[model samples]
Target: MTVSENDTRSPLLTVRDLAVDFRTTDGIVHAVEGVDIEVYPGETVAIVGESGSGKSTTAMAVIGLLAKGGTVANGSISFDGRELVGLSENELRKVRGNQIGMVPQDPMSNLNPVAKIGTQIAETLLAHGQATRHNVNEKVVETLTAAGLPDAERRAKQYPHEFSGGMRQRALIAIGLACRPRLLIADEPTSALDVTVQRTILDQIATMTQEIGTSVLLITHDLGLAAERAARVVVMHRGRVVEQGPAQQILNDPQHPYTQALVKAAPSVAAARLQPQVFATERGVADGSDGSGGSDGFAGSDGSGGSATAKPIDNIVEIEGLTKVYPKRGSKEDFYAVKDVSLSIPRGETVAIVGESGSGKTTTARMLLKVIEPTAGVMRFDGQDVAHLKGKELRSFRQKVQPIFQDPYSSLNPMFTIERIIAEPLEFYKRGNSAQRRAKVRELMESVALPNSMLHRYPSELSGGQRQRVAIARALALDPELIVCDEPVSALDVLVQDQILTLLSDLQRERGLSYLFISHDLAVVRLISDYVCVMKDGELVEAASSEEIFTNPRDPYTRRLLASIPGNELKIAS
Candidate 1:
């Protein structure tokens, strides 16, 4: 795992014994150990690791994005024949977004809300003087189009909030590549997107970088993405490069145990084992039950666990003729996010709601939550019509049904400690006093298998998975009967996801919690749900027991979703 001085020649970007320490109240925290990575010209190299493996710290270090109190105490970073260590903020600013570009993981926060997409991209070009005032607009259009945004000219006028998650991500990349920087650091750029969108964006990135001879430092947890996109893969663990080699070799014939564990931990790999070698989940795909004998889904191969069998349950929540229409603001035409969708979730059950991005899954969940009043339809929770409820009744309703958002990081208050974040709900609900709330927070943390010591840590101190566990603990603090889990584990690693799923299953059994789980990841749904509801284009295409859906799918769209999963009997090299 050690790279000596002999390994430094002809490297576009070189790191020698990089170390990062965060100054905290608990004293200096060693965030990154002595780490080293190399990115050569025209090379697409990936830094792959689980949450808290220090993959991101190294990426941030390479680009000088490490914030205040985070010091790179050791190591020298040489990029493009220049020493990057000890550069002033202003000096680094000149290099960043010009010679070295970054595609941050979360586009929602990365993009400026007030700026138009075109202007944001144009600013990058303007910063580097790549385009004059008059030419910047044209260059922006061309760049946006290259990033795979259709009708770049018209789309350019839109603000960051107007674009969908995938499109917003493209805009971020467009901004990053507006000047065609020599090195592009993509940090989990495809994680927020669906499989199709992920492939398209990755392809666009790969093609654009290759065409311009730009090297890429791809930081991601998705091993499949690393395999498909990166030429060389560097497996990182706890701020160290445990393994580095060709993608095919590292992925198929992984030498490091951690790398092998990551590959084996893929939910898609579990999907590969299903009969017909397809994945079946709540992702609006017909439970891959075509009788193809491709037998395998989340059914754990080792026999310790497997995909959940879909079974009938007593009704807990039901939506009849659900419809949500959004006014086009300046226009009279309305956007129908959910259309005539009917679904039912039984007590102590999980019903997966699957769809591509912008398929109205979130809108549907919101309608059920009554966060946004439904344009039409009847939502019944615990056998009461909730659609028409308002005021205090709605507040009471929300207490009984809570949600776990897709990004647990943002859902949590960054300024508050984990204890306070979880305690906020308990305080608001007037469930207990300060001491009682603290006790409840600890209990909730224990339920999620989080370390009690983390109770005092802030969001900035915890890893993605740990932060997600905090979110779950906070959700459970309300002691709700039905929890709407929206892509809860989509932002996490496979191993973390497995642990979360196991925790959720254990919670359901122990607490008898009913869950309306919504996600595009079918394998995860199969692992947890008792029933499945497949949605496509704002409509429910099919609904059945988990076993019935997987064994006897009646919808073609459902079947296609199953087929789209990347793994099947194909034994990856390692």
Candidate 2:
């Protein structure tokens, strides 16, 4: 395809008929095939697709960071009128951080854990000959501030572990844009960040790139984010470019089946959970299930019936002035992680606690799950004071309430097979014998939509979504009445996230379970939660029904959070 007359200028980066393959024990795997994309000077082009769809592979190949045994079998990659396919390691190294900066997906893994932030940033500048030892410190602080880190001097002295997730990501952005590269490739840059933090990080990138006239190649699975951030969109599926066009045009009226499915599956696009008709007609409901009444079995929050109702629900768990504080090292002062926050979870309904990192959402969840004792508060579960529970009483409380951690990869025992992982709970509770435990494991797997064939596989072999399913199955093994889910779907792609939400909703209806769903994605919160609690800096800013909070938010923070949702400006085609 030839460039249009309007965009006739030579592109800063171009990939024509790019094909990438990886040699494995079984055979060669085609990771990318006949993929073509272009990013003109100062333009932002996004590659959107599901996991394993070759989006990241294309980016990695472009920057010559392909894994071992991976090769560019065919096609061309041109950067600034320079061919990169056959470049040697030394040649590619010079082009990598100097000419083409890259902000990887996971900040924790990308940033050197032992190094100070300032040293890492200075190393990038020094390696590229952008600064001298005398001025490296100054340059590091400047870059850190440019990446939106406040108090760069103090922050630079800390390591990656000392910073929050958003801050760590900002540090990486600083490293990526330190030398003012001509092109930047951000691979799922803010996938795990809160919506508000995500907006700020992306905005920082946009401002810096635009100021320097640097082009961007954004690879993400979020269609909404792609539409809002990039001027042009390239949809990839199974290593092929299925469609490419203007961002708004593709989002509002997607041409390909895969693109349409992505738009429909994105919860951020629909705004509300019960309003399936808004984006349903385009390609059915987001879950790809029948749109019958309460298809997921959960009623709307507006009292219609099914999973939710307008009527006041019975309070299954209630807390008064919940507070958690950690002692400061070598000081009398304490760090207040959660301060005087109070909320309630209604029986058979979902109450979501929404906030950014260190905003007390997760702290509150940990307190509820009995993982941590509250500094000062009163918690009543099923009308029983849980703060004083001990011995058998505490054990009884634990069996009635369960927890599904955020990272499925880290939460499950990697060495254990799927069968043992799920059945461990049954064995611990002594609910059944070996035969009965195996049978119960199968039932749990089926409930979460996993096949019995995967029972023997370890967590390492499962996809992110599948691992989360295993976590859910384990959580339900004991038939807990209330479940605490901390950032459950934040790491999943839109399709897998949709499926998990649907499964949670169905399970809630079938078993009348109450959920304390903690998350930063308001879109996901709106989809699954009947009630919403907005938290900030260890305090509850706003609490109301999901509809009221989204439609008529009273708090400024709530309004800002809603506004920051990606693709909020675009109107989805009905």
Candidate 3:
């Protein structure tokens, strides 16, 4: 819990009384407030908070990327004793990539869609005057290789779409590290990636940063990753610093109530899915009592009320001999995204579909949603044939079942306010007019624990967690019998995920709703689902009650997944 040697009298970067405001039409939205933080040289500092905690805004303000209508109204941001508060955009841009580099959370936003990635990276080096035309390509290849991209020479010429999510993230990291800036700000670099890929990407950054002695301001909601990777932790709430200290201390002995709640929500996802007991950790204060490594295995509890609902064993939705294949002209064979898969979700019960990236979990969900027709399958929803349903029948089928997507950021329209986002579903079905819809929107917001005042705010104005809540509210607008929650809480922070999970559980119990929850985090699935279905290579490898699946994972893939989860006992030594 003690501060390490890196915490000297003077820091590499320091901020005091920092505040930001956006002059919107309605009023000024106080985004950040009276914030003070410091990042020492050769130290990694993680800013941890739920959505709307101003974590990303702080990072953006540091790099001068504050969005339209936003301005830093108060306080000072100093880098190496130089003030940056009143600096011009041109000056900030020069200082940004040269002295401070950033790796954004979503690669799609930062990456140029039309331009070649190699040329884009070369531009970064060229901007800083670090590489000539002759050496630029070589530098790009070397940097890409260092970022862990395979066939860096040829891959550099490819467009952003040609690369996978993890590779795209690596490419972004390559650009950020291209300048070899003294400070690197990585905002949720691994949020979209699977666990294995996440580990690999983070480890690459960790290794390279150490070799170059680059300080990192790591902003993410994943407490497990923060605990594993960061040296120091800063917890922010409502744009203020709630807690700040050593990563081990914050993870193991968090002082603030908010910090304690977040730490308690860190799940060993793999272990929990395998068995519930792994999640039963003793609650302790700063002294770290009940020491058995003070680690909780999976059961990924969202700090919600504990109650078990008994349900019938019959599958509410059943798919038999499900096969989906896409045929390309002149091709010898079709692409089997999902092949002969069978799965079931019990009535008023939660069923989780889990797998690595591109393992067909989403494809299965799409087939269930009927967005994409299955090439061959016998699907039943509420004991009626669904695969055969089309047009009006399909519309009615959709009414019975709804879907919550992985990224709420993209799910909701940027132009719409919170009220519009929630009301779109109600209006589509002609459920109510303006006044009724407004009332329903308010009720939905209350149900999702979003502030009623947020109804008028745009998606760009809200934080990550808040936006997801808006998405949840929109999903709940139809009051469907079952919802296909696809990574509903993945983009959220530990505490926010806890709140959302608790809300979903409460809603299900009160409304008699069922869920087909799809996620990569096994711990989340274990906490929310009554039944677990593990998928691998377009096949259902294991399916059982939560208790049985966790207690006795039958498949080798399931066992390996349980083994890979980050647990308290598996702490990487400093």
Candidate 4:
């Protein structure tokens, strides 16, 4: 798969001096500028960058699917000996999905909601002239099966809402490959999926593309993943090509500062385990403090927390035999979203719950946050039974325990300014007068490292990281003792993710904040957690210190998850 210069297989797709522009209310914003890339026959190329770095813009221009107000400013996109810039919509339709297929980022938005999954695939195949009405259903089943979806026939009959995240992504892949195009553009294909499901999707893409001799152009923010999947890695920053080279070369010896920072910030599963002892909690009790503060020196972007060890460990939140069950629509037995789960968060240390999408991690977090009522078992917060709290007591518990959700874009209300958003929590709690609340909001913003300049700006204007900071600031506005962070950094770029992790570590050290960090990423868990809890199928498979979980995982499911971390294969081979 090493595409040598001398190995002159003609480029399947080529872009020369490509530039894309969007017509904003103010003026024309140059989104992509002077970008050049090529994918040779059967070669896989990855364009990697942070959000708004023009990676997605470049791909959109190539496929003639630019959003409204966007147009190709200047570019020569020659695909298989033909120029695609000036093609009419009808003409482009003849070319699209027939010769150039695309698997868009979010299957939820990309896939039609009202239609059956089978009919959606049928539309693609019929539009591309890949199938006649007589054989389209058979083709649909074949395509879904090839994309790694189980019970393809039955799944085809279901609606998208009925499908799981991974299953929906597979359906997109099935549609993308239905026509067997000469080239496929997978845009952030598995960014929101679980690590194991991410691997399965990527593997399916590789297998299907290789079977059809189709080249690939992958677009992602994950450089480590690019290194593992693509033969060549193209690094883009600020609408320009910053670096381009072999995949391993980029990971092992990156030249550009941006690229180097990405590699440094990316948490590798093969990296050393971080050992954390307790930080001093508010109660002033010291648990066995052997001062075992072993660290890997993976100081996230802002470089915070070196060896923060602390005093006695107190259980800020505890759950014993917690379970949530619902009656199935047509089945005899109930469905357990979370079952027989017992976990505890130390007063001043992070306890991370790591699992796949349906592993009940988020469900556990919701129960702790009191978002939903648990069906079975006991839940306690700071020695008080959570299940028994009512009215004023429940309100008091909610004031002490806040939640930071997964998608900041959706978690934050677009109508509210940063100032108002942060002040709302204080206002609801009737903490102080208007003057005091405003001052507290500003202090909370500073704690999360957001500038005061952003106070009046709405969530629509700020970036993903900034909005997350706003969310964090609001969570801290309550001055809560325990914060349940649910996949906070999963949507961010590596550098932003690094900075957020560091900020969390800093806050925990300075304020003794106990975090119930729920994430599917083991790497992030290792970087920020003292204790790690592994979950599978609504059950706690393993619980131990972060070091012990990473170094000597006892559960087979835990081992499989560690193995599924992207780029683990490269580390193993090396």
lDDT of predicted model 3: 0.79
lDDT agreement of model 4 with the native: 0.85
What shift in Å separates residue 286 of candidate 3 from its native position after superposition? 41
Number of the predicted model whose TM-score against the real structure is largest: 4
- Please give the range of 10 consecutive residues that has the lowest summed lDDT in model 3: 279-288
Taking all chains together, each candidate's TM-score versus the true structure is 0.78, 0.91, 0.80, 0.92
- Per-model lDDT: 0.78, 0.86, 0.79, 0.85
Across residues 1-574, which tens digit of lDDT does each residue of candidate 3 receive?
1247655557888989899998999999999999899888888888988878999999888878999998899999999889998888898888887899889989987899999999999999999997998899999999999899989999999999999899999999999998888899999898888776787788889877877788999998877777767778899988899999878777767788888877776665433332222121221111112232211111111212122332223457877778888887899887788888776665666778888887788998998998888989788998889988878887888888988887788999999988888999899988878898888999989988888888889999887778888887888898899899999988777776777787888888778788899898877877787667778888777665565566667688887776555442445222
Q: Candidate 2: count the clashes.
A: 6
Q: Is candidate 1 or candidate 2 better by TM-score?
A: 2
- Model 4 alpha-carbon miss at residue 229, Å: 0.6
Q: Which order, best to worst by TM-score? A: 4, 2, 3, 1
Clashes of 4: 4
TM-score of predicted structure 2: 0.91
Per-residue C-alpha lDDT of model 2 across residues 404-456, encoded as one tens digit per residue: 98899999999999999999989888997889999999999999999999999
* Models sorted by lDDT, best on top: 2, 4, 3, 1
RMSD to the true structure for each prediction, in A, is: 6.8, 6.3, 7.8, 5.4
Clashing residue pairs, backbone N/CA/C < 3 A, model 4: 285-312, 286-311, 286-312, 287-312
